[model samples]
Target chain A: MVAKIYRKCGDIDTKEMLFLPYLRYNQSMRETLLHYSFDDSSSSLSASGAWTLDEVERLRTLLEGYDKKLRTHSPETLYLDLSQVTRFDTAGLILLRDYIRDWQQRGITVELLGMSEKMRKLYVLIADAPQAKIVLRYENFLAEIGKATLRTLQDAYAYVQFLGELTVHLLRLLLKPWHLRLKESVYHMKQAGIGALPVIALTAFLTGMVIAYQGAVQLAKFGADIFIVDIVGISIVREMGPMLTAIVIAGRSGSSYTAEIGAMKLTEEISAMRTMGFDPFRFLVIPRIVALIVVLPLLIFFADMVGILGGMMAAKWELGISWHLFVQRLYEVLALKHYLLGLLKGPFFAFIIATVGAFRGFLVEEKTESIGLQTTASVVNAIFLVIALDALFSVIYTEWGL
Target chain B: MSRNVIEVENVVTRLGGRMIHEGVSLHVQEGEIYAILGASGSGKTVLLKEMIMLLQPLSGTIRILGDDLRTIGYKEASALRRSWGVLFQFGALFTSLTVAENIALPLKEFSDADATLRDEIVLSKLQMVGLKPEVASLYPSELSGGMIKRAALARALAMDPKLLFLDEPTSGLDPVGARRFDALIEKLRDTLGVTVVMITHDIETIRGIVDRMAILAEKRTVAEGSLQNVLQSKHAFVKAFFKDINV
Candidate 1:
């Protein structure tokens, strides 16, 4: 029957190469092609040519078709003759092994024949090994939502724990200031505080000018252009200056903190510190937090000064309000409480940024990509917490009638 | 009767104003496991890097698979690169991708084979390197030192290249694991018919499976050949290196 199929094609010399019903030679030049002759009545199959990596797809399709046909026919036994296989590799062998396993599962006795010594060794090595299932993880929408919510809660808990540890370490260092890494603190101040000066000044200056211009437009309609000083002074001193400086520091230094600590963690430097009897929190976290705490208030103060200067300039240009009159109005109306209130939020914002950044750094896994991921999370979390804390401060201050 | 798969001649390399390899030369024949041996600062790695075209020698010629490394075009160079595989010392598996994806990456990029076929090839290569199929979904960071080496080897063999380059393949493994690694390399060479070129300091690996070797010392090839042929040299480094191993 197999020979008759080839004879019908009439492309090859089937009579010369054909041996029997179960042994028909496939005279083709493609070394990777697999040809099989199946004797339907006896359930005997003879396959020839190459069974290698290149023939994986074809071999799979052929074996799958045979699997379906075998299921329909319900053959008691399947004899697979591979004696004429010209080439073989692990790819081909694995596919054959899997189909054979499937056939056995379907109550068909599969017998492998004409196994070479090399093939037998390969068979024992690969076939006898314990197979592990490939698990691709998938979750429905609700499960994903639950996992995300849990992750967020876990993150919040971890952050609180990190803050508690930081406070303990801070108190310990406060008792012995000599144990504090003063040099590292100074270095971080230079990086996060001094290095951030120019950008903060520029952003705050522009923000003050925009506010002055917008407020002048509205006040000029009411012929109360002098009130622009009140709007710019109160907003920049009490809200804009501190919040903008914190957001900028969150993006710049907070990201750097996470990346630096995360890289150190990935390289096992954090572990090395612990093994060497150095408290990583006191050594790494405290220096950054102290630096930001000391510097952020100063940064906000400087931003307030630059922002008031910008408001003076915009007021003079847009509303013809003299710089002297603006200063007089600022001194009178923008009370010391407003300036102190803005400065007061500085330490809280700094603590949030530094702690969130360093805590995320500790969460980095061993992979380099984890550094990038944690750094991004650090910046985002710092900014979010900074804004939320500012809102809380506003609510508390308003309730207290500050 | 095997042809020369790699041939280096009178190579000179200078890095950072220091003469690393004044004049070095070596050849690796097809179907043989060749070892490049030297001390820490002897420029053995520099020579290997030069052979693989990562670093060019100041003056010399390296003919790999009959193509001159110095003057080869970009198209020809990439084509030649696809015909061989390289395994770095630290496994260098992409941290972002899983072990299976790392192994299947080259197949996906270089071949027209679909995802299913690529997955099968990945499993087959994993089995070839004696790894459990379950390890396929694991990341490089999750693997132990030995498993990382095995996974990296599987990835290197993904394209079924004619040549395999290994850098300190058994450097970090325990004695038993190192011996198993050497056996696996030997078996792979026999089954896959690939020429193996490796840089190693392991005396056991040098004695166990190396068909031929070249000892690099003091900026040149001090000795080159089979164990008997290399032992014939009276070089001080050669004698000291093999003194403890009684092969």
Candidate 2:
């Protein structure tokens, strides 16, 4: 049936034969056609068509063909005749605008002639319309530097304010210990701390093993195999254990915090909480920060023990060092200050990660894109702060001769 | 008489264990404004989605522009889709794109027009929708409710579609804005000679704009015809829907 219909409607002549009388009776019918001619001194283009979307492709091709020919002649003036255009729409108007603008840009004087009243109204509506222009201004090097410095200073100021607010909340919670939501804090601890244990342990163990294996190879060359214990024991206790754990938690939990709070903000649930006479800091931020601060040191302590055990295994396998000797050397060389220094940084790292994540979350705008951007910024900021604070702690520990 | 631009026959659609439409059927003639009216949760939006081919009915035959939807191939369906445009309830403009870019999207995808022609078309479309060209640079978030609706209408009309579908075009507008939008729809129908299918419960729109209407009730279309024909309907739900309105 479709094939029969297609065969009957195959040609323009056949369609016109069947429908011309009806179209003529319709009285408002517009025939689709294009006629153009160019003289040696000037050019004239005439279009007679139902200039709508249905004829857009054909009109575009016809106009482009004429454009090529007109350019070759380099005519001083061009006349566009639209008197025969019985019907016109946006598509047709736009094509006409493009043609006139192109000719004007080529320094050719173009005249639009004889448009129907309706077509003229549409043409005037679009042709005389005001469009917004975007202008880009170039900046000097010093100006760019000044802008960057100002932006950085603003960000620092905002971060300092966030830290001050968080500290105030923490102090208030400490003063009124009963105000802490213990159940909510424990739920967050299970999510951000206990749920993270396996991956953290695995990564820490592998890091310690890699260090021991690599150190054993070099220590054996100098008959300094026993010193491998000092390298693994001191580094794991003083730096690697706490720093690695913090980095893992930042990637795992920091992004979650940003996404959760950002979604809540988007849905206006955060505002609802505020309207209900609940302080968002006391209800939301306090629980997350307190849970992270309490659980991070315990996680680091667990990582320290597991990482040293992994180092001992690697040392025994590669250096022929007995487990008893490795343990003895670890106990002999590792001091109380090394463990204390590493564990001391855990709470600060947790505070920074939780604060940055929550801050970025609250900063999210209403758009869905803002959530993704804030989540990415949360992870990056948390990890960077953790590393920077770790370095600062190292400098302080060294200066104090611990 | 104009041919049926859209013919939906005995469509049965079930979504998520709930029967949305059962054996519901309606036909919209060419160059006519057809409105679908229903109470809340009456599956009017779902039926519109089915008509637009965005959602498939469990069982039905939908013939659009004389082509049976199920028999058409994917390419043919896409080409058919280009022949029509849909305006969603909340604008549904691409959040990341500026108004001009959003309007230019369908043209850029379907037409081989040059960049300058496309931009000109964007400006023309904005003008046609009664928006200033300066609005072309604004994002959807920057637009007020009425401006967003106008921008979405511009985007829908970008390709000069022969058929236009609107879902609640005047729901969130002031009375003056709603009247203006109704006038715009009437002007578009007169100027473009296009068929329009709208889903709305706005009494003023029903009285002023729609040429025909269908009332969905009890998981099916209960009454369909001119506003007067529907008002004369003896169906309980249909009568209840128009009881409070001074139509």
The estimated TM-scores of all candidates read 0.86, 0.86
Candidate 2: list runs displaced more than 4 Å: A1-33, A37-61, A64-89, A98-149
Where is the poorest 10-residue window by lDDT in model 2 chain B?
Answer: B111-120
Clashing pairs in 2: none
Q: Work out the iRMS of candidate 1.
A: 3.4
Model 2 lDDT, residue B26, Cα: 94
lDDT of 2 by residue, A1-402 (tens): 111111234322121111122332243223655555556567777777577755666667667766776777788888888888876777778667767877899999998889776677667757764433422245999999999899668767888898899889888888999999889899999999889999989988998999999999999999999999999999998999999999999999889999999999988999999999988888888899989999999999999999998999999999989999998998899998899889999999999999988988888886658899889989998999999999999898889999
For model 2, the TM-score of its B chain against the native B chain is 0.97
| Residue pairs whose backbone atoms clash in candidate 1 | none
Local error of candidate 1 at residue A67 (angstroms): 10
Per-residue lDDT of model 2, residues B1-247, tens digit only: 8799899999999999999989889999999999999888989999999888899999989999988887889988998899898999999999878898899899888876666667777877887789987788888889999999999999999888889999999999999999999999888887667799999978999999999998888988899999888889899998788888665
Candidate 1 chain A minimal-lDDT segment of 10 residues: A12-21
For model 1 the local lDDT of residue A297 reads: 99
Per-residue alpha-carbon lDDT of candidate 1 for residues A1-402, written as tens digits (9 for 90 to 100): 353323333432221223223222234323433333334333666667777665566566667655665665677777888888887766578678877777888787888889887677666655754344455566999999999999999999998898888889888888998988999999999999889999999999999999999999999999999899999999999999999999999999999999999989988999999999999998899999999999999999999999988899999999999988998998889999999999999999999898998999999998867888899999999999899999999999999999
The lowest-lDDT stretch of 10 consecutive residues in candidate 2 chain A is A12-21
